[model samples]
Target: MADYDLVIRHGLIVDGTGAPARQGALAVSDGRIVAVGAIDGRGETELDAEGHAVAPGFIDVHTHDDAAVIRDPRVDFKIMQGVTTDVVGNCGAGVAPANDAFRAYYAAGMGPILGESDLPWSTTAEYFAAVEAARPACNVAAYVPHGVLRYNAMGGERRPPGDAELQRMREQLDEGMRAGAIGLSTGLVYAPGAFARTDELVALAKVAASYGGIYGSHIRDESARLLEAVGEAISIGEQAGCGVQISHHKAAGAQYFGMTKQSLPLIAEARARGVDVTIDVYPYVASSSSLAAMFRLGRGAAFETAPAIIASVKYNKERYEGKYVREIAAELDLPIGEAIRKVLQDEENTPSVIMFIMDEADVRRVIADDHAMIGSDGLPSEGKPHPRLYGTMAAVLEKYVREEPLLALEEAVRKMTSLPAGKHRIAGRGILREGWQADLVIFDPATVADVATYAEPRQYSRGIDYVIVNGEVAAEHGRQTGARAGKMLRRGVAT
Candidate 1:
């Protein structure tokens, strides 16, 4: 009998640890890597990878694919970009331990992608069980959503939690951590979670820290107040004694085009002060969010305006949807408030805007920073989605590492794999060492490129010829191999 289930021979291995690339073969047994050097052995299967680069499968640290995972387990958008694992429940939104009422509340933003029958579980544990049962195309890890937790514990009302409410929320967070959440995520720009005072977040984060969980956030603002938001996240990390991850790190809006330089220093200072602060960013300049977020500066105001905006006929103008409110108001000859309302009407109908906010120099500077990791803040539901969903990994490999030479290949791979895995405590992943899980990708760096554009968003990327998830072939020759071999990852004492 063969000593191993599979062997990939003669490939240039970039182990995702920021190490120098090596020319070698890799052996896999069961679902874990057994060897990482020359192995002249008989095997159940052999894949020739000569001249290709084999690295740890890319881990997308930030994504909004909660419903899409159930609706389409293939995860074509990410898989095509060489992503083998995606951490969902980001930006304080997810689908676990939620009832029909909660589902109805978030339907506009999350969509009705998963049917009641499709969701056979409710709690995080049960949700993972269902994911395991379904056998997805890529591994899925999740964070406990602060928005969902607050909504579940305190309903839609936004107020500082009283002693009893705070205690109850703490218990709920504790339960979620025990049930497999990697960390706690908050959306300070979105409702309920936005309503939470900084003290309440610090209190909940303390519980997460006790359980070895990190604290991540979609900050209160990505534009004018980005510096303050970063400061607040750093403060929370300090006060709660927890690691912090700033989700979809960016300085949006023309007003803050070059503010990344100013904001990133706050993160660096926090790290210098002994707080473990990190951030993730997609490759695209345009951000994706509910149309409502553009109009309302605060959470409650956005919620109040969403309905009336959807009702207006003037909102059907697609040309104005992705632009800024002031520009739209000028073009429509309407007041700023009315223009904002007109744009936010139906969440689905409201064309997801692509605000050109960040300067190219700023993008390069932030992404090149050692403390940063790659995150495709990609939402799969939008009709004309951001290209990052299908282009993130390829963009990094092709643009940053190859074309611009802003980052070395090994350094870029670290941002995509090990950095995120280490930050989130994902075990047996993000590395290509012996005894690790055999989640790997083989691609041609010279030819790898992102084909998807904002105008043509559904196109798959190029040059990623093979992707293996847990020792199973998920994508072959840039095409899905119809393998649903992914698993649900849980938090553990050691990773």
Candidate 2:
């Protein structure tokens, strides 16, 4: 008879605790890690992990995979890259609490980034249940997206919420929190959410705080107004008395190059003043978002100098997919702004883009920050999606740890695992401790690398040898096992 369910032996353990690496064997039993270090017990199944790095499975703390998990339960892009958990409903965008208004919003040009789906629920609890019914390959946690709340309550009204609307939004957030949402997230750069004032945000943050949740934000600006935006996020947290997470922290645009130097300090100073705030960044120089929204936010200026590649378009797939917008404009014989308007109108304002705007130096600087964690921020849409969706975790190990060596192997694992697990309150996972859930990744650190490129963005990653979720092998040797061991995690509750 086997003494344990599984045992992985002789690998270098980087236990996701920021601890020094050590050679050891680990044992699992009934979906929990029963032992770490020397393990003499025999197991029903075993894997020899010699010469590889065995660490906790990566936790993607920021993602927009709310619709992807339900639409395609396999989630191969995340699992193949060794991500065991995905925190969705990021940047205040989600398809949850699917009321009439939310359904209309999804139909009204949100499909390019959020993916098209028939929203089947009217509450966050129902949404979580739907995710569970789909049996995603990785665990999922979520935020009650402020944008959805606004749309549900006010229906795209571009003004401060009236008293009745404010209360309605508050009630929805309360319901989501009771259903185990991790926090309240706002995309202040996007409309409806953008229309809200600071005090309005403070009110909603208070609701999340009451449920012991944090506040995450895609701030009002990431360009010249970055500092002001950062201040507002901090103020909201301080006033609401909750922790804050700043999503995909970067200064985008040529003039704002290297602005993280200033923004990072501002974050540090806020911490000194008793603000509980942290940041997450993707390991890429380019960003992707809805073409119409960026243009409305005055981000189109960057497109004038740096060509923007159309990542997805419903109307003109051959003409726009994977082509630069500037090239499209050249063909049409129109100015850049006019061309963008024409295409947006034709596509029903649903096309997304990959815009090269950030500096590599700034990306390195932000990633090197001890308080900064990693998130893919990848939009899971059709037609040439950003490569980060397929490659973020692997890229961190290959580029940031092995190639340029910005972070030590153990420290980087901490950012991906325990750092996010602790901040987001994902209980009983993210660390390889006895009695913890057995979510893990075994990989050859030397060979681990992201093969997905901007041109070939959908390719799977390389060197992730095995990905285990809750003691079941979900993927092995770059292939999925068709085992869906994932769960929908609730705040402060073990899966």
Give the best candidate by lDDT.
2
- Cα-based lDDT at residue 250, candidate 2: 95
Per-candidate clashes come to 3, 0
Question: Candidates' lDDT values, in order?
Answer: 0.79, 0.93
Enumerate residue pairs that collide in model 1. Answer: 97-122, 309-345, 310-345
Question: Can you list the residue pairs that collide in candidate 2?
Answer: none
Candidate 1 per-residue lDDT, tens place, 1-495, comes to: 988898999899899999999999999988888999889896798888888899999999999877677667899888888899999889887777576656666654445222123334557777777777777799888898888877767777868887887887788778778978888999998777889989999999999999899999998888778899899998998999999999988876555678998988889998998999999987766666655555455432323322221211123446553345566667878776666665555334334444454567878888999989999988675445667878999998999989989998999999989999999989889999888898999998899999987667788889998998988889989789998888888875322
- Identify the runs in model 1 with alpha carbons over 4 angstroms from their true place: 112-120, 298-340, 346-351, 493-495
lDDT score, candidate 1, position 305: 25
Top-TM-score structure, candidate number: 2
Candidate 2 per-residue C-alpha lDDT over 124-152 given as tens digits, one digit per residue, 9 for 90 to 100: 99999999999999999999999999999
Q: Whole-model lDDT for model 1 versus the true structure? A: 0.79
